[model samples]
Target: MREQQENAAVLRVRGLNVDYQTKKGAAKALKDIDFAIHAGERVGLVGESGCGKSTLLKTIMGVLPKNGDVTSGRIELDGVNLLEVDDETRRKARWAEVAMITQSALNALNPVRRVGDQIIEAVRAHRPIDKQEANALVHRLFEMVGVAPERARDYPHQFSGGMRQRAVIAMALALSPKMIVADEPTTALDVIVQDQIFARLRELQAENQFALILVTHDLALVAENCQRVMVMYAGTLVESGPTEEVIAAPKHPYTIGLINAVSVLGSDKQPISIPGSPPDLMEKIDGCRFAQRCPLATSICKDQMPEAVVIASPGGERMVRCHHWQQAEDFALRASNPDVWQSVSAV
Candidate 1:
């Protein structure tokens, strides 16, 4: 465990575990997850579907779905633990301090209300601002996210998918949050629109200097935008470190599998799939959560759970959980085919 004597982190999640009370049993969705994001840092949480990436975001926003529960852990924003706060305080702190931009902007938007009204409502609810000022801010925010200033008056149906996403982002900006939990902020968008949204997000973060947590299944996106990368699998963080370093040399087997799925554009190799599905969380985990899928997993891995280890690398500290991580073959060299990956310089 890393110590935080300075206590200046923008956000900190410690031993966070989420569970669902289903008929089968208490299905653990999140393991003992721990990570911290500093001001102006772009931290990407990358993993496959059903890996608890979105659930983690929902818990952070205090909007856990109907059956979700925080089994144990602490989520702190600016040194204040959100888990301990009362409902009123959580309500006040929710969008004000920690905001989240959900997956679908079109569906997320209110069908009947005008987009401008929605933005105004968000701002007014958080702070005691007058309607006139709120309206002005709404227009400014619309312009900020590259939306047409006049289009703010239109309903959600009037906007395109991209515009709807931008509007949602604009609404999330109403309070000027210190941190943003964006879960697939660019889902289902075409390449051009995705680039536009990401560019706007980067610009806003640069201007406001807020911590950003980008949760997505796309490893390529994470490699491009994030300063640091945290790879999650089966509800646990398997590896985390500088993005380039992790991309170049992943320490964990699951991370290697992720890299295998995407060949670096500059490299000359073919993309390879991991060849297996994620383990079912409903079942009891007797050993490493990834042992079932890890090609390098041995009998020991099948019987014992591995703890996170700070692997030594010239690039950076890549915290990996596989006991045999140091012995695994490097996946970096396999990404020789430009067909599977693109060069960062191209971006």
Candidate 2:
């Protein structure tokens, strides 16, 4: 039986499409991607750097550069179309409703300005608040994200990479937004510090009851922290489901390939890698985006796209797009050694 519909979605993205036009040619940066985020849900968008992960976020935040345009789609946050709102309305609706801690938020800060001033500025921009009240709120934010409240007076250059990131997060929270989209929040940091950031972000999300959309290339961490996972390739969503089920056993060939590359997921006893690169967005593709690299590719896969198939499990439901997901799963189950499987699947 199908699960009962939960009419509790906070954000719904339907048939979303984005494109870029240059003198050379037109590029489909985002295909007909569809997904929904419920209240307080933690969803991870996992994919390679060029897989249109970041581009999709930019479109949602209403900050797409002049080069990119929404060809067609609906980004409804709290029942309003974000794309339909004008600049003036988007400005007011932005931070107070939906804020983003974009990648490299440390660099997003002005080097000379006091970090406290930045938070205060953000708060005052959206509401009628004085600097004194803003500073108090800023101090609370700093403490919440693990930065020293006293250091709020310091400039961006004075803090370490992690500290600056915490400050950036503090700034993003000045409005107490309903949802936050964090793009590669821990990128370029050392592994130890990366762990700290991930832990801290998880804690913050828990306390706020805010929906979190985590976009990153880290497959292992996504499986650990996120409630659900969405895998994308060549501008389209390839797989999506609860983290545990997808990590334990993947259905889509691309999802399997992602798991195979991650040592923690049991795809490899040691470090294994998925071979070949993804197709370029600047060029047109007639069939599956991963057909060029998929080991299970057939004439049907090469010449046409596969519709999504639902895989049910104890943890959660998974939606995969592949003509031969079941076939690939059967082969891998029989072909891989038991001992090798043990190393990859510690859970």
Candidate 3:
């Protein structure tokens, strides 16, 4: 049965679970995750480290490590099951139908090759274009990414950090993909450069009308750039909704913790760190994955898994996985007080 909506989405992931083999046994990296993005939509995936954000991206890209396996569920691209397709079809789909902009531009690019050559090769790999045509396209791409067209001949080391990232963006755009999954594309860059890179990405995304999935740890960044946001914890999606609604009134305790963890610039209030570490994935979780760290956790939360319920709001409908989401607004209001989290230990 198709779990996707009747209208369909550009990309849909349903009941997806991933595991990685360890010495003891297999560790669950991702739990029954479900989400969909429509054409030209912008969505953000935000979580602390080791919350399966990268695992989800790698699974969708079909680049999971050798030890990792997709245990169950389906990943659909425009209604086609990506997980069920043959290797040949998957190979052709990558970088052509959907593309990725990696986290670190420095490591993603080859130090020895000329940036232009890399871009030209990427274009040729997907399409049978002559060298002259490829070169012209490379020049145009360089221009589009804020790099001087003539400087395409230079090696990656010669370009500044921001310029290198821009070049990577150009390479991702070369195939004119329908969707782009950017995994922390602004990491390691200065504040100014991060702003510039995202600005360019937003402009290009608007111009081309491609769906975008941005994975990051920055809640503020998501609030500013993404139309919708999904929050993950201990390999499970705790909450997701329209950006404004989620940021303003988070329903899940974990979601509320994440919002309170960041403070506005120049604000008198200090950022409140969420206490306790994430649960170990290799071990079995008896109940709610977040019960150990959540301030509002109750006996039921420690004994049974919570189901995701859709709640209606003035803005739109949102999903939250919690037993006590009805008290979310009250808890969210209390979460701002540092004393509320004093009992929990910080990492």
Residue-by-residue lDDT tens digits, candidate 2, 1-347: 24233456778898998999888887998988888888788899998779998898888888888989899999988778888888888888777888888779666799989999888888888888876787789879999999989999899989999888888888877788888888998886887888898898889888887888899889877876799999999999989999887777777767776776666545347544656677888888767888877766777886777877777777666788887887866745643343433333211
> What TM-scores do the predictions have?
0.91, 0.91, 0.95
For residues 1-347, could you state the per-residue lDDT of candidate 1 as single tens digits? Answer: 13542365888899998998888888889989988888888999998889999899989989988899998999988878999989999998888888889888876788999999998888778778887887789889999999989998899999999999999999888899998889998977997999989988999999998889999888889877898999999899999999998877778877877877776688876677765677888888878888876656778888887888976656545688888877655534443334323321211
Off by over 4 Å in 3: 1-8, 344-347
Give lDDT: candidate 1, residue 114.
97
Q: Global lDDT of each model?
A: 0.83, 0.81, 0.88
- How many collisions per candidate? 8, 1, 0
Candidate 3: C-alpha RMSD to true structure equals 2.5
The better candidate by lDDT, 2 or 3, is: 3
**What is candidate 3's lDDT per residue for 1-347, written digit by digit as tens?**
13433354889899999999999999999998988887788899999999999999999999999999999999999889999999989987899988988889988799999999998888777779998898889988987888899999999999999999999999999999889999999987998989988988899989998899999999888987999899999889989989999988889999888888887898887788887789889988867898888878888988888988988767556889999999999988888887787665321
Worst 10 residues of 2 by lDDT: 338-347
